[model samples]
Target: MSRVPFYLLVGVLLVAGIAVTIYRHVAFEVPWVPGEQRQVWEVEAQVNFIAEGESAKVNLALPSNQEGFRILTENTGSSGFGLSFLDDDKGRRAQWATREAKGSQQLYYSVQLLVAPNAAQPRVEPPPPDQDVSWARPYDTAAKEVIDQAYRRSSDAFTFSRELARAFSGDRQDENARLLLTQFDRPTLLVKLLNQAGVSARKIHGLLLEDGRRRQSLTTWIQVFDADNDWVIINPTSGEQGRPDNLLLWEAGDQAALEVQGGRDSKVTFSMLQHNEPASVAVRNQLANDTLLNFSIHSLPLEEQSLFKTILLIPIGALVVVLLRVLIGIKTSGTFMPVLIALAFIQTTLFTGLAGFLLVVAVGLVIRNYLSYLNLLLVARVSAVIITVIAIISIFSVVAYRMGLNAGLTITFFPMIILSWTIERMSILWEEEGPKEVLIQGGGSLLTAVLAYLAMNNPWIRHITFNFLGVQLILMAFILLLGNYTGYRLLELRRFKPITED
Candidate 1:
């Protein structure tokens, strides 16, 4: 057979597996090990206001796809107040309504977010028409002076925003910036200047997430729509262009952060705490929001996930079987019987599975020797052996229960049909090739099963096979390569060694 097509197929499988594995790791930030943990922030917002004792309503801005954070869950707390979430052209908002409320009313909103290092940035939209700004007297002339100076130095919307901010920042400030700062806040003034210069700009609010922080207020930053319609964040005082990792945007649109009707002196404060959770949870949550995850194991229910966690390890056991039988010349009763036995060993611990297997096979051989006197047909003989094996397992289970040996209960995990076939094969071997050859093959099967169990039960191997689906393809490629190997086995090489005659 031509080896060209076979090697080409192997190469294709290998490359595909590697591409998928790398993309998942880099895109999702999925860890290579199960023990890796990710940081999470639990932030709580407190809205406090004095009520005028009438029907009260409060609306508060909610967090959305801000860069570097994935919202896991959000909840609102207010007694006797109905809460509902609204999504519109602006952004997400939570509104609380009550028929009647009195002095010192408080509403709470809590959000739990996972810190994702590779999270996609907040969505950007096309720039809206610039808001018309009319400044009075000297301020109009001063704003134009700053705008003209920034426009000369900038090439695009982003650079223009940077230059505009730089004109009013730190040591670069001149009379125009100081004059504008005297009346309007830095963020508002920057927004006005950018809008007057034909740039769509808005004031954005965010909270600085500090561990165990309490009673914090939102910080104002300017958001400018650049030439490509992408949103650019600029610090009004420092001329910085991007959001810091710790800044969590609370409001990104032109809408108000908090609005209260039938109430006065409305204000909102925030508190947050930092903690850690398994990174698998973050990946699972992130994938849950993606349509592509419908085919992933993470989308399955908990019970199915647990079941597949063991099922995925079967290929690893098969790989071990191929390596041992094909590469090392190990002989067993059946081709894949050792792999099945290794799976049983996972449910029943190694030592317990070994002892139970040896006991059943030893006792089963004795019964088969007696059945040979009847001269039964092959099918009937195999059927009788299966029934006998089941009976032995039942009797042993009852005996162990009475004797208070719980480990004996797991003996039922062994596959009855496989055990029957193994007993039949060993019996025929003994009758045809003698007991010496039977011991050789039976011991070899046991050794193969033990080695396979160690491989399948390994923590790292189990994690890799379950978390990365591409690993199965890689294993299949290796198995195909092993199948195509025509060289001498390790054991065969010793038997065929060249003799050095004296």
Candidate 2:
């Protein structure tokens, strides 16, 4: 074989692995380290209303154009009612309907949001003209006076809105603000005052998120459009200029946060809980919604994902076997047998696995030695060995259970067919090469299996192999490189040591 083509293939594998790993880490935001956790908030909204005997309908506003957070999952809990989501120029809303309702009804909308700094931002639009800003009687005069006072000290829309907010925030409130305050709350009043001065603004409702909070209501804030056609959030109470990190915008625009038809006394209350989740979990959840990436492992059902998590570690064990057998000249009964044994070890811990393996194989060898006297055909003899192996496992498992050795029950995790084959190979080795050679190969197999178990069971290795698909390519490259190596094994180098000593 041309070494050039071989080297080129290895180079391609290495490069491709590294490039893909980097891409997944950067593009998909998959973490490099295991057990890294990100803070996530689970926010649930409870919509309660009293419906009469007639048909009833409810519309609840939902969060959209989130900042500093991404919604990973959203679901509703509305039993016995028809539910549908509506999106329009107004905003996103969830509507529920039921005919002939006669009692208090409750509906739920819950969302899991991942905290991320680079979360998507809403498009910037100039604020719509205020069509409903007119105030009646003395309140109309008071609003005009308040807007004129703030406009005189400010240059643009943002500063004008800030000045108006500042005017009513502190102890030395403007007389006009005090008069307006009697008729309107601070946020609603600010929106009216800003619009009266020809500065585009509106009142937005948001939730102040805190860990483990329940039954919290919305906090109203002023949203003003700046000269650049971007929405600038202002704290109407504190006169703050930007949105706070803890604030979640739940409702915007000039629409009611909730509306109920054929129902009365309707209200929505929010409950939120915050916790940490592994970065891999967050990536899985975030990507689960993307249709194009549905073919990836993260998109699999949870049961299949968990199965693949274990399955992906097999390559690591195979790499360990290749290194032990090819580079260290370790002898084993079968080439990939150590890998299967290592997988069992993962399920049954190191010391317990070692004990169970020895007990099974030692007893199996004795049984095979006796069966050989029957002179059975090869296929029938191997079939007998498999049945014998299963019988041994069952007997041992029951005995262990009776004795309360729960760990021993895990011995069943060992592959039965593989164990039978191993016994068959070892028996043939014993007959052909004698007991001494059999011991060497059997001991080598156990040692290789132990080493492979250590590699496959490592937390970092398991995490990387599961999260990064590129690692499989890297492992394949390494196994191929080891396969091509014809150099002296580490044990063989001992022969050269004697020559150098002389």
Candidate 3:
């Protein structure tokens, strides 16, 4: 191919890629590939109760400002009932009250949240004093002893609270800890001890975010205010200090999460599910509450989108193969054969795919060498090799399956005809150019495949290729430009060492 035509082609494709990328980003407002999808969660707090003929008042706790998340909007699924936010015993409560009510009622208060990067923590108020905490009989002495030990052994508020929590569970605990554990739950007792130590702390309730969960109860944990005004929360049972990454801080204070009046068998439950939303939708919603995801791939059927996700990365594999062969002087079996092999490796994984490919090719080569004695024609010999390669793969898969290796079954998708042809060529190369050249070419091919696999498997590379279709055209332009190189490759430079020395 003339270098001029190749250069012109590359220039054309490069322009096309850039132009399309600009159009998508400017006119359609598709986000840059990295910020394409936001981790958005839909969390619901549900209240169920039986209402008598008397007036009914149902109060439920609601989530406020939390870290690393921007609250989008909340839902109040209430019909024919009064809804209001009141400062009850709980810090903030969503009260649904009605007069002359009867029968069953289920209410949901849901919030949509988008996770943001490097989000700042919300400001927390100073904890209240431990009011009327005069313990009964021996419990009073136990509380004092626990607090004194924790404060003396620790240097700071966070450490002091952790020490006080640890004293209740482990064998190193004293009689004070045993007495406290028997008197109150671990979370409640931990806060009481921290308060006695003059550290401002409280017992807060939240739910560990588990997807598709229902009828979940609130879990209690210890939250202490340090000197610098940051909230230091800890798991009371394990003494592991820190808020859990996925916990939803629902409410604080001594009040229950849900309270019911003039009713029997009242209960509250929580349900939460998470979803990955494209930034296009977030942008649209931020613009004017547009429901459309705005011309993103998420608009496609999920099955088709998944297929496209894999198919789009093939160009990345091809680009890797081209760079290795053209610039680095790697001798692959066929021009793009290693690309296909590497693509398959993305599915079966590197170790399994390499082991399977070698096993199939090796057995086929041995079988073909034996058949060479029959003086077969070229067409018949190729056909025979293809069939033999398939049969060997089948038997190997069966044995691997019987042995409980599920990864082996994925090898069924390996291009059997290509491997057959590779073995045939390597066999011919072995006789004509010797085993040294055969080994060199085969090793080079395997190395290229491995490099290509690594490139294609990168999460950032996969994201860019699948989300931004223009990147594939840019990749094609890159491969085209690399194809026109006329100088010696990196490996070929070593072959001319004496000339360089002169």
Candidate No. with top lDDT: 1
- Give one digit per residue, the lDDT tens place, for model 3 in 1-502: 5668777888899998887766666544456755568777788877788888799888887766566565667779877689997764446789888886788888889888665544457667776657656788889988888888878888998888888888887775898888778878888788777776667888888888887888788999888887777778888887788777788778876568888997878887888888998775654343223233233455567799888888887888788887887888889888888888888898899999999999988888789888788999999999999999889989988999999999998888788888989999999898899989988999988998888889988877876676567777798899877876788889998889999899
TM-score of each: 0.91, 0.81, 0.52
Q: What lDDT tens digits, residue by residue, belong to model 1 across residues 434-456? A: 99999989998999999999999
Could you arrange the candidates by lDDT from highest to lowest? 1, 2, 3
Candidate 2, residue 204: the lDDT equals 84
Q: For candidate 2, write residues 1-502 as lDDT tens digits.
A: 5799998999899888888877777656778889999999999999999888899989899987477887788999998889999998767899999887878989999999888776657785667657777778888887777777878988888888888899997884977888888888888878777776777888888999999999999988888986677878999888889999999988886678999998899999999999999988887887335444222578778899889989999899888888888898989889999999999999999999999999999999999999999999999999999999999999999999999999999999999999999999999999999999999999999999999899999989988888888888888889889999999999889889989999
Ranking by TM-score: 1, 2, 3
Model 3 TM-score (2 dp): 0.52
Which whole-number lDDT from 0 to 100 does residue 184 have in model 2? 82
- The window of 10 residues in a row where model 3 has the poorest summed lDDT is 286-295
**Candidate number of the best TM-score:** 1
Clash count list over all predictions: 0, 0, 0
**Each candidate: what lDDT?**
0.89, 0.87, 0.80
User: By lDDT, is 1 or 3 better?
Assistant: 1
Q: What is the lDDT of residue 160 in candidate 1?
A: 97
Judge candidate 1 at residue 279 and give its lDDT. Answer: 83
